[model samples]
Target chain A: MRYALRGGKRLRGFLVLESAALHGISRAAALPAAAAVEALHAYSLVHDDLPCMDDDDLRRGQPTVHVRWDEATAVLAGDALQTLAFELCCDPVLGPAERRVALVAALAKASGAEGMVLGQALDIAAESAAAPLTLEEITALQAGKTGALIGFAAEAGAILAGADRLPLRAYAEAFGLAFQIADDILDVEGDPEAAGKRLGKDAGAGKATFVSLLGLERAKARAKDLVTMAELALAPYGAAAETLRDAARFAIARQS
Target chain B: MRYALRGGKRLRGFLVLESAALHGISRAAALPAAAAVEALHAYSLVHDDLPCMDDDDLRRGQPTVHVRWDEATAVLAGDALQTLAFELCCDPVLGPAERRVALVAALAKASGAEGMVLGQALDIAAESAAAPLTLEEITALQAGKTGALIGFAAEAGAILAGADRLPLRAYAEAFGLAFQIADDILDVEGDPEAAGKRLGKDAGAGKATFVSLLGLERAKARAKDLVTMAELALAPYGAAAETLRDAARFAIARQS
Candidate 1:
């Protein structure tokens, strides 16, 4: 579990911290929430790399948990990491009881059956489907699988501050799509050496990703448009949320 | 997830409900907590039955989740069920924000690293140890793997009612050990038809258990003593706690 969490961009965690900062919540107070999201993400990745799932051999330039240890260890580690995520959310340092409870509930909703799990299930089902998923279908699946947790992270500050979550949620919804499209773009054109893992997996699987459905140029265009919309959502917060706007741009501009 | 949830004894859920009722919390209001514990249990079972884990096909007289569906489905279903457990804990019907937050925190503590997961990890590590675990070691492992969640269920009512938790916690600690001992006894002497799953797995795996360490008669006696202690812990509640007492007895006497 520690190995799985050892490295990453910490994007989701960063979103939580920046959003919390906007609400005047201290980094110390928001640390658990940030860690919780990252832990949850790591768990998902660990499970997704299992033999019965994506069966990937490498993650972050190292052997996947199942490959390095064994499938049973990977499964248990993922389960424990997930449990830890919720435990972190329950930390008293998160603030008032109401805020803590709200964070717990929101994280659950974002990660559970109706959110990330549903998206994953759909993605699996799509693999065996007679026809490939349409653009809209892929979009919806991405919304759940990738967007839900990002949405939760971006909205955490507002939730902690007892402010309206709408604008941040809007920003997250757009930002998530852009982030995934960037991933799709990476899958098509990325250097495996730079990415530190296998690339072009979607093509190998013959799965319909944004790049598959829309072609390279159009997918890039769509990602940029989503980034623009994500930035626009911060108009209400003005310069107070510039870091978040940078995060939006970073989602698209990163090479890996 | 639903399939995994079906056809179980619901022992943990029952404990939560009965404990809540004793504390003057309504069954309706407590329903989510009951369901939450059951969901968490189901998730653990589903994951434990995966090919790389326990590799069991049968559960509750039906195929296990991975056997009935696929390993990927089992993984996702377990993950979703776990998330659902936390979400259920967040239900407004659980009580005031403070009570709800307490439930979330307590449940997480009981099920996470310092509790169930740590137990499971130790159990897995025991498999490759140079020597079989001692009786004391097995006891500690079961305390985490099986006892912690049961402890949480048994204490849920007091948490909800803002009552003292010590008595129930004491009762739960004893009851959980007795319950595990009963399971070990069944593994030694149970009929597969009655048990609804394979028996003698511990012996097959060369793992130490209560029966292996204590001898059958002494183990049974230990279980009986534990039940007595569990009942004695409820002395404060007197007759009002009779249902819980019956549960303690049933844990040892049940065929399955």
Candidate 2:
């Protein structure tokens, strides 16, 4: 399990902490929620990299869990990590039981059938599909596969504070789309050593992506527009949300 | 997901309901918890039947998830099912947020590395060990793999009612061990048609089990003694727990 969680950009964890701070929630109180998102994200990556799934041998520039240990270990480790996510959310330091239960519910919805898992199933189905997905379809697919968890992370602080989550939700939606678009851009041009994994698998598999459907320049332009929208969504918090706005910009600018 | 859940005896669900009734928690309010345990059990079976895991082609008399669909679908379905378990535990009908969070925490601990997953990991490790597990080791392995969740199910009512759980926990531990011993007995002598899956796989793989270590007659006797202990554990609940007592008897008597 430690091997699977070794390294990452920790973007989702950052969202949880940043959003919590925006709501005036202490970093100490929000730490478990931050760790929960990272653990859950790690679980998804472990499973996605399984031999029966993407069959990748590299992740974060290290041997994948299945390659390092074995398939059974990878599966079990992923399963336990997923369970750990829920367990961490129930920690007492997260504040009231109501808040913790709320977090658990939101996390489950975002990561389960109606969210990430649905996105995965659709992606798998699309592989044997008669034609590549359209730009609109790809957006919808990414919304579930990646957008849901990101949205949950951003909204987590609001949930913890019992505040309205609409602002954070809007920010996450735009930011998540921008992030995916940037990922496509990175795949097309980023150095493999910097990205820490194979960069051209989407094209190699003939899969549709934002860049594939929108063209390189158009994709980059779309990402920029989305980042602006993400930044604007944080206007309700004024300068207090500057870090979040910077995060939106960073999403599109990061190499990995 | 529904395919994976079909046709089980639902002993875990029954335990949840029965235990809840013992604590005066109405079945209506306890239904989601009942469903949660069943979903979790189904998820475990689906993943356990994966090609890299147990590699079983059949479960509950039907083609296993991996066989019915494909490995990728099976993996995603199992992942979603596990997520569903957490979601179900958060159902508002289950009661206050405190109770729900408590349930989620207990469920996560029971199913994760400290419990069921640990047992599974130990089982896999034992497969390639220098020698077959000793009787004591096998007992310890089954305690986690099977006993943990069963204990959770049995204690869920007490949790819901904010009642003491020690009695139910004791009952469940004995019942779970007895159940596994009965399973080993069945594998040795039960009909494949009745058992709904391949029989004798443990012995075929040279794995140590209650029947192997204790001999058929002795194992049967041990299970009977366990049923008595399970029954005795329910003494505090008086006639209200008679059905649970019956369940203990049924655990050993059932063919499947």
User: Model 2 clash pairs?
Assistant: none
TM-score of chain A of 1: 0.99
Candidate 2's residue-wise lDDT over A93-131, tens digit each? Answer: 999999999999999999999999999889889999999
Index of the highest-lDDT prediction = 2
**Candidate 1 chain B — worst ten consecutive residues by lDDT sum?**
B112-121
Candidate 1 residue lDDT tens string, A1-256: 8999987789999999999999899999999999999999999999999989888998887889998999888988898899889989878898888998899889999999999999999999999999999999999999999999999999999988889999999999999999999999999898887776789899999999999999999999999999999999999988999999999999999877
Off by over 4 Å in 1: none
lDDT of 1 by residue, B197-240 (tens): 88889988888999989999999999999999999999999899
Q: What TM-score would every model get versus the actual structure?
A: 0.98, 0.99
Among the numbered candidates, top TM-score falls to 2
lDDT for A124 in candidate 1 is: 93
Give the CA lDDT, 0 to 100, for residue B192 in model 1: 88
